[model samples]
Target chain A: MSRQQRHDARVPIALAVLGWLAVAFFVLPIMALVLRVPWSSLSDVITDDATTEALTLSVFTSVITTVLAIVLGVPLAWLLARSNIPGRQFIRALCTLSMVLPPVVAGVALLASLGRRGVVGEILDDWFGVRLPFTMPAVVIAQLFVAMPFLVLTVESGFARSAGTVEEAARTLGASPWYVFTRVTLPATQPAIVAGAVLTWARALGEFGATITFAGNFPGTTRTLPIATYLALESDIDDALLISMVMVVISVVILVALRGRWVGAIGGMR
Target chain B: MGWRNWGYEVSLSIDVKRRIGATQLNVQFTVAIGETVAIVGPNGAGKTSLLRVVAGLISADEGRISWDGMVWDDASSGEFSPPEQRPLAYVFQDYALIEHLTVGDNVAFGLRARGVRRRRARERAQEVLDVVGGSDLVERMPSSLSGGEAQTVAIARALATEPTVMLFDEPFAALDASARAHARRLFSSMRSLSMARLIVTHDAVEALTLADRIVVVESGSVVQIGTPSEVLATPRSHFVAEILGLNPLSGQLRGDELSLGAMSLTVGAHGVDDGEVIAIVRPRSVSLHRERPEGSPRNVWRTTVEAVDRSDGRVRVQLGAPLPIAVEVTPAGFDALATELDGDVWASVKASEIVVQPA
Candidate 1:
């Protein structure tokens, strides 16, 4: 055989074995959950009042969270990527801290800041007679807290990676700054934005620690799919397995649907 | 559109100084309506930067840019208009077409940005694309376009804006040879428009053929600015001469006889009064010989070949001392003479081949 052909065919046994082991480590749990699903009672478990409430709540809250993230996170991403704001690095780190922070810690931080006697929460309570804890808004806030950083970081990298020459050309062609941002910059970074939104939605759908800690698990109000799965683990393991399988299916479908954009975003970041 | 009177007024005037990286760019020039000026220089000579300053993409550190009696930028006053505030269009080197939009939408973008109706903007885009010979490219995506097609679409996009001033930064640099020729003809037709135009290019042929006046820049400074023929016949700096590929020798002119240091050559008829002059010689006109021969040529000199460079089917023999000049010869001609590097060779040029101009 040619030397190059032999070299191309050769695989390091240690690296190949370790890589396969890593793949098996991730795949085996999902395979076990799929196997453990009670096939005859799957429909019955899914249609149960607790499962329906949790699924409906999770879908609605995650959708709102994704939309809110796009609305608020996109502009912040643009500022971080393109503006000369003072202490921009510090601001970016603060915004994305939740991405790496332990979820339970994020829940504690949110509670401290937004609880009844908390800093902003006391003012909100006195001024408007409103309480945020143990509410639907609180669930959304909890999801947004942990989920938005994925979107902000992804779209920020997109904004930074896209060349400014096209925007400059648009300006010279008489496009106003707002028009350029809307028609040119946003559209040019759409792939990353879409990938980021999907990631944010998925993260919100799967939220557990933050929602249970800050929002306090409440049926049909704050308890989302992940919380339902955890609660079912205490009473009925079969129901927990079914809910887990549903989440896995939904996540797999979404990721597969947007595989191209997700892969492109990762490549662009690199 | 029939503003045909040349040199009527200076429609655009710029006197700007700025520091760009390690290069301090100081340039001043004026362009009248219906005038097309080509800026020519080597890489990093600030040609593109000069265009950017005028386009309002980059503000100069000092001085003023005024067009049609209106100030666009004044550093002392701290008054600078952003690019969108200027009635200008810039065709970038890479076309910079919006990849997400169809070619029609890309061309229509400027009009839409200016608050034109969508239907009207699309119609205008179609008309402009037809004018630039890109009607068939309207539905195609920018990503699907070839380099030439994208360049044409970019031109159409710029033209659709109907701008008062146009800036082109190496517009043809990305095109193939045939496409470059086509684009040159297209740009030549555009010169008749009544708006001021500035084109940045390193192509000598483009500068000479397309510009009413050529501005030669070197190390971020304006070295020379004149008509193409004037600049070509009397290059003021070695950079300009090298760019135009001509050998310029300073000499004293007495009647038709020009003295080149210790040597003298009879030059062609120049009607100017006798004084210090510069003579331009084309390298292709200088012939190399193995031995001095009896000839009708008026100028002959013995020089040693300093270097032999062969590229693109032609050989350039760099002759050393007495007159340090380069002679371009065909490979067949060079092979016939049997000249080697560092070998002594006699060079001769006809008297009429020399162009004499005022120093």
Candidate 2:
């Protein structure tokens, strides 16, 4: 064996200890929730009308948010990937701004634009008599605002990678521009699109600070899983832990299914 | 290789000026209907750029490209039809078949783009796949196919649109020798089906064997256009000669004596007097010896062998010394010479083998 290989197996003791503690630091919360399941009344806590209402609202809002993200994000991804519009850099920066900003800040920004008596919101109230905040649709908007950049950025990179000579070849074969995009570009980037969708869905399901701040957490309307967990924490700690366990389980299952490569793809896309 | 365009009329005329990065392409060429032209050039010689412009992927700065009396691009009139409106098909080197699509669907992409119904498109795709003799691959995904299979699917896809003109850029460069040979045999059958074909390749043998007319491009310009035999027998430039495995030496020529490097080579009579000239020696005429010949000197030079490349069942030895020259030899002949890489050897050429061109 080489001299380097002989010494490579030994690691510093303090590093080993600290590394174990780091794993425990992130993993212990889920362990705590699992240990504190309160198995006796688990059914009561899980099937309560309020719990079901919040769970249904979470599913509905997150699903709509994901659909909305795909609808708006794919075209945005295409435009950013393929077109040479003026000020595209600025536009891309704006699209990705939510990814780096705190979720609460995105909530405030959305409120400022779409809330009653807030900039465009005030104009919207005056001109069209529309009040967006504290509505079911506002719940979707809050989740979408914080989650869209994941989809857009991931799919944009996919578009960039696929927008090459194939698209040109498709065009040369008498494919209309729209046909080329749908037939060649979209199919080529399908893996990235699916990966982006999974990320968007996961992010939307966990949206809390934004939904609470902008959508105003009503039990059946805007109290998504994260917001419901937060509310239960203040009133009933066991109930909160149960909701936390549920969130943890779902996130774990989804993320475990995706494993490393796809998450790395999304992270790299970001 | 033997197809003739004698009675056919010119269908595609490209006289365009384009600038790609620092290299500007100012080229003029035409291909008659039923004529397949092979564009051979070094890398970055704007061969692909010329094809792209002709295929309508890029517009010219100022010129006209018309096919079948319809102007595809006329910069003077500010008129340019985008690629989808043009009746042409381009197959890129990478094949560009969609992995998500079955071979059948990939081939049907163009028909769908033209608003054909699903059943009709699939049937048409099958028909074209049959034309390429790849109907068995119809249900297969592009991911499952080999490089050769993907290329056949790409061609089937291109032909599904029934385009009048087809442009291929290094279509066989990605394949192994056997696959390339198979693809070549399949592609030669296309000569009877295609109205016009322009292929960009750096392989001289491919250019010689596949094209009815060969256009030699260098520095983004058309340097020569002739039959394959004409270009192979009389390559115009050092680049073309080197690519075609011809020994090209540029030097000063006075009367019948040509000064090449430190050695003077005797040549047949040439009309050029006391000026720079390029002398070509066919590789077959170049003889190699393990040691100096008994004679004092002729066109013999002691050189070192650099590399040996075998193609088309013939071995070519690259010799580097006073000049780097490619010499063709049979495998048996090379074995008889017993040459090793970087070993010293003597090369001799006959005066009758040299052809002089005014430089």
Per-candidate TM-score against the hidden true structure: 0.84, 0.81
Cα error of candidate 2 at position B192, Å: 1.8
Off by over 4 Å in 1: A1-3, B1-10, B243-359
For residues A1-270, write the lDDT of model 2, one tens digit per residue: 888987998789999999999999998977877898777778998899988899889988899999999999999988887799999889999998888889888888889899997888999889999899999999999888889988898888888777777788778878888888777788878888888888899999998888888999787887787888888889998898888888888898878877764655555453
- lDDT per residue, candidate 1, B99-156, as tens digits? 8999999999999999999999999999999988888999999999999899999999
Chain B alone, TM-score, model 1 = 0.71
lDDT for each residue of candidate 1 in A33-130, tens digit (9 for 90 to 100) = 88889978999988999899999999999999999999999999999989999999999999999988998898888888999987998889999998
Native-to-model Cα distance after best TM-score fit, residue B323 in candidate 1, in Å? 22
- Candidate closest to the true structure, highest lDDT: 1
DockQ of 1: 0.65
- Full-model lDDT for every candidate: 0.88, 0.84
CA displacement after TM-score superposition, residue B341 of candidate 1 (Å):
13
In candidate 1, how many Å is residue B76 off?
Answer: 0.8
Question: What docking class should model 2 receive?
Answer: medium
